[model samples]
Target: METALEKRYIDFDATGFSNEELLTIYKKLVLPRLIEEKMLILLRQGKITKWFSGWGQEGISVGCAYAMNEEEFILPMHRNLGVFTTRNVPLNRLFSQFQGKENGFTKGRDRSFHFGTIEHKLVGMISHLGPQLGIADGIALAAKVKKEQKTTLVFTGDGGASEGDFHEAVNVASVWDLPVIFAIENNQWGLSTPSREQFNCKQFIDKGIGYGIEGIQVNGNNVLDVIRTVRSIREKMLQDSKPVLLELMTFRMRGHEEASGTKYYPEGLQDEWKKQDPVDNYTLFLKEKGILTDALEKEIHDSIKHDIQKNFDLAQNEPLIPAAIETELNDIYAPFTQHVIAPKGDQKEMRFIDAIQDGLKQSMEKYPDLIIMGQDVAEYGGVFKVTEGFVDLFGKDRVRNTPICESAIVGVGLGLSIAGMKAVVEMQFADFVTCGFNQIVNNLAKLHWRWGENADVVVRMPTGANTAAGPFHSQSNEAWFFHTPGLKIVYPSTPEDAKGLLAAAIEDPNPVLFFEHKYLYRSLKAEVSTDYYTTEIGKARTVRQGTDLTIITYGLGVQWAEEYLDQHSEISAEVIDLRTLLPLDTEAVYAAVKKTGKVLVLHEDCMTGGIGGEIAALIAENCFEHLDAPVKRIASLDTPVPFAVPLEQQFLPKVRIDEAVKGILKY
Candidate 1:
């Protein structure tokens, strides 16, 4: 347990680098800082709306930037602008992006330092901090699985260091010995909160000891020290296939943002930190060693000023992002095609779980880049044995068993998807998806519409009520995602639909939530087609047809509706199983409502804010004239699913579907 002061700093040798190389790195360090000052000018001039200054952290950014290969990735935060500048992101494009012009990387979808060019291996950061740390682990995992020698570098603030994602990513990276570096930019403050108030630990470097990874601290303002330490750590990570936690000690010299005044910081703190500024101090250090002369220094400053002025003026005159909503909607998902291999047999009888297993096997075989990950999914065969024997078939590299961190599992899956690999992630129980809800809703769901990027990821949720399993294990949470715009939700009841839809979801070019009914995993069996086929997403299929009444349902609700119709043979009830919930198959729903002239919507989820309400409304708007009776909805009670069998039975609305159907028929 060495204290921060007791720990020895690696003395960097100045003789290792010639004057030219040191000057180049210094030039890279100063450019972004100067540009940031120009941006502050733009902010005051009302040319740019907001700016997060990279004031004191240029040394860490530039040092880390120089350590990586041109092709290696640096998943950067807002303060790491030096990484972008070092990577040679065009001055005009970077300024244009800051000015919200159409020629930028995100095409004005994002104005702040919230965009990244995939080609440059510089993935952008979202407002939420730690999720990107997990994604960086996944990118490193992808490189390892593909046998590509690549290292991923991710930066996080001391505040973000306390986030759960940081722990999950470190745990995963350590367990797998991933090639990555978790660079904690310890700027002494997380927004207005001091580091001491955020964590009980004395230093962030010691936090890595609990996770069994190497930890090192560097003087962030010393560009030479940072560059030497990062270069050595990066080399070790690539050679040994282990992650490192490097803490860069520095301070935020300005407010968190231009608008956030420094009133919260201690008095004279900004001026005190300004004295140790990386750009200025490092320049003075270079001049002392005779590596940088005043004449040469002035030349660099003049050159940067001229360049910044030219780029800033050009950025303001560029075209703005298009105002068309249709274009934005169209870019929400990238187009993808799937190769289907028709089963030789007409159909084969199989359980719902087996059909899912078969679908995963087929997809993995067809697409070599397909990766399956979840808790106990590899050697343990998953909780329900759905992924049994997959590890032996695809090997441990492709079929991985992840820790119980649901958010990182999904976050990593999202990263893999963006890197052009298909990842099928399983949530042990759909009820626990709340742990990863942020990643699903904010990052995975919004990436496409936000930047025209496709997150080709499928999260297989083992959903619906399991008899006596209690609240946490037994929940149908599909309706919650229905309210979100950029997600596709799929719930299948039968073995055939399960196999086809799972395959479709794996190949679909969008982030999809595939809900599998837990009760039906083994109980339901049918002769599913062996051929490679996918039930089209966003389409509804009529399980049973009748003229007197129409019942639209999905998942276990479909089973309940069919059983009720069978018992009352003379009722003439039509049952429509909505395969995909998000793209509501309005045509199929409208046709059924018009023909029967009576409709009932049923689901296993709760009634309030349920998909049933959406369906009921869709019917009222479209088929109002043809309906003989008002469209009604039946769903579970608005309470947590109880553990007791009787209470659970009462909580679910399955039994009441029969009564609703009878009441509808009479109307």
Candidate 2:
């Protein structure tokens, strides 16, 4: 009773391959093995620092690489040496990368397996597992958007399947039906842990079903079987314009890397797997089919060995990277010069919700390339009705209504942004962002740092607690992103500031995590300007002038401080709203702290790792001498925001103007 999936793979085995094809498979396996062994020797001799052998999984890598055009893109993992080698990455450069030499693909900055060459059409390998899947989706989507003929193939491990990124990437690829292939190398182990222990599911291919994508499990040890199956699947994918998942059932004969040993593996598992070695098994199959004579096989092996030795020698003699390379790389994170300044004269007032809507309208009108997307945002005006009339105004394409997959929503936004579109993806609620955290933190946040100014995306999330919307609906996770690098964080308290700051973020050539306060959406109103406007990204705004105390806050905290100041005119508290936290307005903060000589940091997030601590540390280190009193912090308690109205209220930051005023007055 074999299922359709199993039957497809079984049929692949019966498909006949020519003698030349069999010989080609044997050559592919031998070449990769020789290179891997040479690198292993280099690792042992301390010439190569690390190595992850594709010893047992060579057949599948070779088969998939051969099936696709060399011009098509590939996002590989650390164990994808076979694919890279087969794609024509020079062996000398590959070995040089391992030895940390200038001849390396990344000039020795990256590990050997993480090497990539634009000329070879192979995108660099990501050391972190599963992230390549999202990158592949982006590359594939870019090709589709640009009407390019090329497709993208991404590799991952069976253990990587358990990670949230795997599900996120697959879901987005399926929804978009992008020309992409997700090849999973089910090597039976995730480091020391067995795949069976990592997941309860019997088949890794079944996981793809949840995302509404086609998937197949193949005998990866069988070179022809793998090649035939992948070829058919890829053809169908390109014709139908869809994503397909191929789970290659394979084994790992070597340790996780050069540093790890297989002592913890199950008894006799390695011995049992050795019987099905892809290279040896494929060579025997070739000989049985009369495709490979002993003399020809020996000649191929000898040539590969000699070539590997020659490359290894060249790599060992390659020079080191120059000091200037490191110095040039540091300038990527330098402060932006085209800063947005505060509005001249009196500040315009507006409701926070209307401010957000106005900001989107202004940004969209300013940049035709800017797109607004999220669940129910196009027609339904979003969950909070903030994007009301956007679709009617901008049409369907610009204001897209997406499916309920948060990860896909964010991933697609990132993809679109990288493809030269300014995308503003809304997460209906702040709490729902947990589903797309990996896309935000791993892909979007790290993309610019990894590639340098190539990936600029903006993610707008409406967050904060106050609506009695239970534990699942209420959350303040700004701290999670405030600490993450390669991102611009903006949380504005006023409608005017929201509109101004969001416009600035959309125009800036960087990825931004724009947080819109849910409770402040329409709580208040003011006269917003009809003219286009943008505020500075990292600079803070001083709302009041006072000498006694400095209150540093953003978003709702700024509103709370304003309210607290209204009640205590005697204290004369100077409130500074830090609209952007990542590229923090340290200049404004230090100046304000110097003027007041006393500081109190406030935020809606939990105390631990909150932006408050970061600001406190900055003030303590730079402005410590001017401080007349210790810096105090006011934040939510360290716990999940509860559903109970009383508990939720208690969880919020308590602002006692009298106490703060009296305390700072004494100093």
Candidate 3:
């Protein structure tokens, strides 16, 4: 084996670039440095509160961005001002965003450094260190699915390679042969910590070999070398045979953030890095090649200063985010206030499983981009026959079967969603969702909030306590996602509601968690509309009207509540099925509870930390004055669901009409 020093650096003499191209690289590098200096001055003057410098790593970013086609996508990390500028991100909006002005791309939600322009095909910058690799894989995979000849370039720091997301993304991209280039800007520092403290590997590029992919290292300070390396990899990636890793050895001339002073860095390290500055090195190379003269360099610097000032002035004069922007949340999920409704008419009754199948078929027909995949869901019709004959109805391309790796399944689905496909991933059972907990909570549940409305994916899992399945198989984990921020959790009790919610989730532009009750799949039937109809994701349905008590529940619990209401006519119970859980229908719950002056929170999960507790707390804090009696909670016992039929019954909440009537009577 070759020594680490020999392997760490690759001879780039084989790859050639013209003098003009080198000068173009020099200009790109100079622009970002000038922009960064201006932004840094603004930060010190308190005109901008935060900034992350891209001073030393400019050559790598500009070279990589220039190497890719204009149509290609780039997902950048925090330290990527050069990439953004090279991709033509407007400097005005970038500065406005930093100043927390309304004219910013994210409307002040994100800082200046975390800017992106979809029109420019620059996806966006994520402040979180390493996770953008998975997002890039997702976008690249999307390009492959759409048959677009676009490659995705993702940039991260050497320190970010230590993150588990980095490994997960690289592994999946290699396995799926995604059109992506993982570019590591090895600046030798992760914030204040040195790269040696994070990993023992001499070169981060070699780490790609473990995932069955090719790896290359280059002098990141050499713009021509970085561009040549990226362009070479771009050719292979576009063919979709394998993903490539290019480690660009660079340095961070400034501290991690504006607030961070370089107190931890060695005394002369910054000055040493200054000598090897990518912009300075590239400028010298261009001048040496006669492509750029001293006069031309001075002109470029002066032009950038003028451009920066023009944008800064425009941003300062721009108006703040409109007052109506505060009400924009109302427009996020659905246009409920618009009062748009399809003609409500009675239709034939169907089982829950049949409704799911029919809804998927309708959605697929409506949206050609929609895709369905799960274990045994293609030809075998799924474990529960919910997707029976889907492979035949839709082609195999639309209906996919996986290798039973739940984490990979969901992780790939997340990638597909990022690629702009409406991916519907299924967990064989609710309990099996545990296999994808990391993907769900860390990626799916938080994508939209973390990235600001670009994350879109739908995950469906069959849940509820089936008596014979035992503890491992009979679990309701909706509560696990209920507390998560960006996820929209839906639990439908009726066949009609299931079909509508499922269709809506497929159409939604955000990540959604659809939980199907196992016990109700075959047993329950309702008259659902044959014509396409969709219920809002975060809305609740008031099934029955009663003044005595309000029963707030979802999924299987709603069915039990219905039966309870049917058996006891003497005491009327208002039943509200909280179809969606994340943006919990707090308004509906509070309204019903206030009217009835009594509330009962119910769910199939164990009482501890279940969704019911959240609902109970909300009501107690908001509707305490209206309550005629203390809130009641009916949920499964605090234990794993038992295997025995009798024990399972005891474990679940089997509240009948008589039990509800007695509780109301006592109240």
Candidate 4:
């Protein structure tokens, strides 16, 4: 029972290829197939812990590689071992990663298919499937902006096509006319789930029509057909700068990994596909053309086996990864010099939003690779008009608008950063950041510590409740990322600090969440420096000095405490504005607590699990002996923000801070 795909591949014409080229393609297919078998053997022998076979799908990957320019980027999934081999990733290094050797790409910090060399422009796959597609879009976007003629080919399984990232990435590419090919290797099974179970489309390629992109399908096992189709797509992409959906229809001939069996598949399904095994069929095709004689075939097979064996031996002897992973985790953020340029003349007075826009303009002018992306950040100038003139100044390529997909914005930013470009992504509203929380907490925050790569991105979030925007729009969500390590949190309260901190964040080599209070966007006015300077991250500013009680706050709380102190002249308080939350200024906090002997932590976030507790705990731990009174925390009630103006005001615990300050002074 030959399937339509198998019959199509069996009759595929190699009309354009010369005899020598046919033989070369045959050898390319055989090498990965042999490497796949060797990897399975190593998995069984405990030399490797896991194995993913690309045994039946080599034709698609190899053929695509054959048709691609070496300069084009490839974001490949785990099953595309042929892409690695084709890109000249030495077999010894591949085996070294598999065996968890120190000589591997990630110094054995990563395993399985998680490996790549920047020189080859191939980003190794992450466990999360759909994000790489978005990453590919970012890479292609970068290429387009830089006036490079390269394209990006990103692959995913049939199951991954259903991911939100797939929709987001393709849509962005279509609208932007980016040179990214969405290559879906439809190998019929995702783990144990069949393609039919994963998607309802007649073909995965059919969905591209809705995205306004050209769609093409080819038999996965036909090397010539795959190469020919991909070459055409690449040419079309170069000419029009539009993306194409290339679906390679094939079947997985083995279980997801070596430890699993194919029992879930129909009994004869494996044997049937093996009859059309790409490597064997291609070899037969070459033989029929008289390009592959028995002697030449034996020589080619022996040469590949010897190469794998040599690499296997080197891998077995390579130094084992250290018992502790801490040694290899240094240089999380790449070092860069910092300098402050003097103000050109008398400092100019500006609102917080203007300061932000100026800071972005300066940073982009300095760093050519820096990109700013968000939902209305481009031609429309953003909903808040914070980036009103940016598109005019930097063009839409650099300051681009995105669809209202918060997660995809962050996800694409992560990709751009990984590809060695700096990105600043804006979440139009701070509360809406939850939509892309996974990329922030999971991907961006973990990359540097896990694999010693910088996730250099600045996520600008317009935060806090002041416009009476109600529950969904008004949230101080810094606490969510405060709990996440390896992320720098910057919440600036003044125009001076906003401009300086944003400049520093742009220069910093790690991921930073820049929290811009929506309340202070136009309200706060100050003399901002026209020249560039970076207010140091992890430092606090003493807004007001007092000795009666220490009041620690940030964002909107800073204004509340200042207003309260201005009214009540008798009660003295030391007001500390924590610009960065993750790296708290313990020295400033300790000195304040010691001088006042009483502490009150004030914030607008919900009371139970807010950053106030962390500050209170810090005061109790390090400044406990200096404290003459107990540490008190004043925060909003544990309820969603209501729409009523009075209720929202009272719900934010603004007036309560005054009461806590008075109570702490009395104690």
Best by lDDT: 1
* Of 3 and 4, the candidate ranking higher by lDDT: 4
Model 4 residue 413 distance off true place after TM-score fit, in angstroms = 2.5
For each candidate, the alpha-carbon lDDT, in order, equals 0.85, 0.77, 0.77, 0.84
- Candidate 2 lDDT tens digits, 1-667: 1111211121224357666766776777678877887777767888767888788788888888887888887767767777877788888877777777777765555676664555776766555576657667766766775667766788888887777777777877787778888898999899999976899888877877887888899888777778888878877876787888889988888888867988988799987777677777766655556677778877888888888888888877767767686654553342455556545444456678887887789788888777787888988999888889988788776787776777766766665654556678888887788887877786676655554433456677888888888777778878888777777788887777788888888887677888988888878677776567788777788988888899999888887888887876776788899888878899999999999899988888888888899899999999999999999888888899898888888898854434755676687
Cα lDDT of model 1 by residue, 28-105, tens digit: 988998898888888999988998877888988989998789889899997888999998988899988888788787
Model 2 error, position 448 (Å): 3.5
How many Å off is the CA of 161 in candidate 1? 0.7
Distance (Å) between predicted and true CA of 635, model 1?
A: 0.6
- Model 4, 267-301: lDDT tens digits are 78887787777777776666667788878978888
TM-score of 3: 0.86
Question: How much is 413 displaced in model 2, in angstroms?
Answer: 3.9
Could you tell me the TM-score of candidate 2? 0.84
| Between candidates 1 and 3, the TM-score winner | 1
Clashing pairs in 3: 564-657
Give the per-residue lDDT of model 3 (tens digit) for 1-667.
1111211122334246665655566678788888888888888788888787887788788888889998887878777888888988788877778787776776666676665566777766445565567667667767876788888888878887787667867877787688788888899998899988989998987788788889999888777787888888888766655788888988887888867878899888887667776666555555555677778877888888999999999997887766675454543342223222352666878999888878788888998877776788888889999888888788776787765666656766765666668788888888888777777777675555433444456788888886579988889888888777667888888898888888888877777888988888888887877877777777899989998899899888887888877876786788999998887889999999988998888888999999888898989999999998888888888998899998888788874335645765696
Which lDDT value does model 2 have at 235?
A: 78
Q: Which residue pairs collide, candidate 4?
A: none
The regions of model 1 sitting more than 4 angstroms off are: 1-13, 337-346
Clashing pairs in model 1, backbone N/Cα/C closer than 3 A: 341-532, 342-531, 343-530, 343-531
